[model samples]
Target: MSAAFAHGLIVGKFYPPHAGHHHLIDTAAARCARVSVVVTASTAESIPLALRAAWLREAHPQAEVTIAPVVDDVEIDYADPEIWSAHVTVFRHALALAHGGAPEIDAVFSSEEYGPELAHRFGAAHVGVDPDRGRFPVSGTMVRRDPASCWRWLSPAVRGHLARRVAVVGAESSGTTTLARDLAAHYAARGGPWAATRWVPEYGRTYCEEKLALARRRAKATGLPKPWLDDLEWESPEFATIAERQLLWEDAAARTGSPLLVCDTDALSTSLWHERYLGVASAVHPRARHDLWIHTSVEDVPFEQDGWRDGEAVRHRMDARFREELALRGLPHLVVSGPPHARLERAVEAVDALITQGWAFAAPL
Candidate 1:
């Protein structure tokens, strides 16, 4: 008999040992006498095998866990037994240690696709613990590449590390401005610090104007080809600045300690417009990163102009483009339904929905 197996072995990367991971280990240990956790990072980037081992060990001190480093031979074919066999030897050794590492182990627990395979290869009963059923596959690549934008997907420990506190964004005339004011007012009334506005239209104009002035100055100074380069680059400095401000709001949110750091508009609009106007579709962009997007429709509300405004034909076209933008960016946004006032209510509800969806909050900090 397989030593009357009762304890299990669990294996994973354990990148920050999030709750989901801790859950797997805990649940596995319950079923088995002891669950040996193997934190695998055969060729991890920068994060050393030793450090990864330490983190796993520290996180699950009570559990009978053994951390092992498996080195796969890269010189041969990716799927060759030569490569896998060597790694399997390391795995087998890890299992052997787990049997007597601290407590009695008898089973194998896994929440990944290859966990069962590993279990079968190692001669352990496989127990699947993924109750979430892949609803939200929060990948390491997405979190590392754009933490601010993808912060909601992170574990609480990682999310807390983010500098910017809160962000609100949405489609054009989507009540982003109204919603921002309402949210700030709500937060302020609740005895919290005030939030920062994303666009602050005046700032946008001023920023763009400054960029234009600089371009004028640069054109005068070096004379870098008029319409071709000078005006083209100078025309949308503000747009680029706003794009960078997307990242800035996070910092501004951190400093404020407010319940919500609302942005009237974010980089998505700026980037889209920059592409449309400045021919910067290929050039450098500031790149904004607002958290929540509220979609506003001007179906009933007249597309009124405040001088710095574009027409419905443009807004309509932009609206269609905005959907594409959201899809491309993997952002979750709520539509502010109804006429003017209805938009306001819908925006409030939509934001409230987003909060519920992400489990993100800091007790007004």
Candidate 2:
């Protein structure tokens, strides 16, 4: 460990501690004697600053992560004139107040807009993190703007707090269709709420159709060249869109209080497809950091051609790609492999484990 500094502050809107955010904090903690995480209550309902503080507390019990109060009284409308003055002013005051107090920090870690400004203003060193060579996805604004379903990028500790949950993940053609349906049935049979993977019904094809439709619609609405717009739409069949969509689902799941919900695949699993399709470097979705990850590998079963069929080589590469990515990220996941029945059995077991874990969490209440 490096020489421990007197104190360090990591300020953020955490929204929730996504894996990337946690990684950054964990990195910061090692370099400092104490880490005080000051979370901004950015909006009226921006995932409770207190809950973020609690999450940091739970995730890094070892680090001295303190939650600073909302000194900046502001809302989400950046366009408003009152926000510009009130926003930066309140935040600067908060930093001054924090730095002025006893046990002052020597440094602050951040990946925010005013990181450098804070460091200079407070007379402290600033730290920056770049997961993909300066391609820092440090925009809490982007995350906040993402539909509620996008909380899938959040850490598992946060996701576990949700009531309705669903995960639909499996290897190529391991009967994910039947399996998702069966899981919903089983949950209902047990007198529980139902969840299903109805997003794409069968991934890719529906998305392709929708993209085509959107392209045409936009062309008509804007009176732009139909071919050009259609081409733009064609290139936009990205993994991020689907990943973002699933995130919206997570929002719904968390809010419904449903016992169980079925999902297709999450960002972690979806990263494989993204990597293959978009050529983007794959990182585990924040949710996978602690959320249970299920790896499907029931090969030797018949593959389906639901309009998104590629050669086995492509599927195999994508599958292994995700598994390798998961391992590299050091996420908590289970690789369910075997025959169809065996695979489904493993899935049930994995889900049961999550359910038990959920129930165990509720036990404290």
Best by lDDT: 2
**Against the hidden reference, what TM-scores do the models get?**
0.44, 0.47
What is candidate 1's CA lDDT for residue 65?
47
What are the runs in model 2 whose C-alpha is more than 4 Å off?
1-160, 164-166, 192-206, 214-238, 282-290, 358-365
Error of 1 at 179 (Å): 2.3
Candidate 1 achieves a global lDDT of 0.54
| Residues forming the 10-long window of minimal summed lDDT in candidate 1 | 192-201
Q: Compared with the true structure, what per-residue lDDT tens digits does model 1 show for residues 293-358?
A: 765654555566554455567777777777787777677676555665676566667655654454
lDDT of 2 by residue, 237-298 (tens): 46556666666656654444234556556666666655655577545454431255566764
Clashes of each: 13, 8
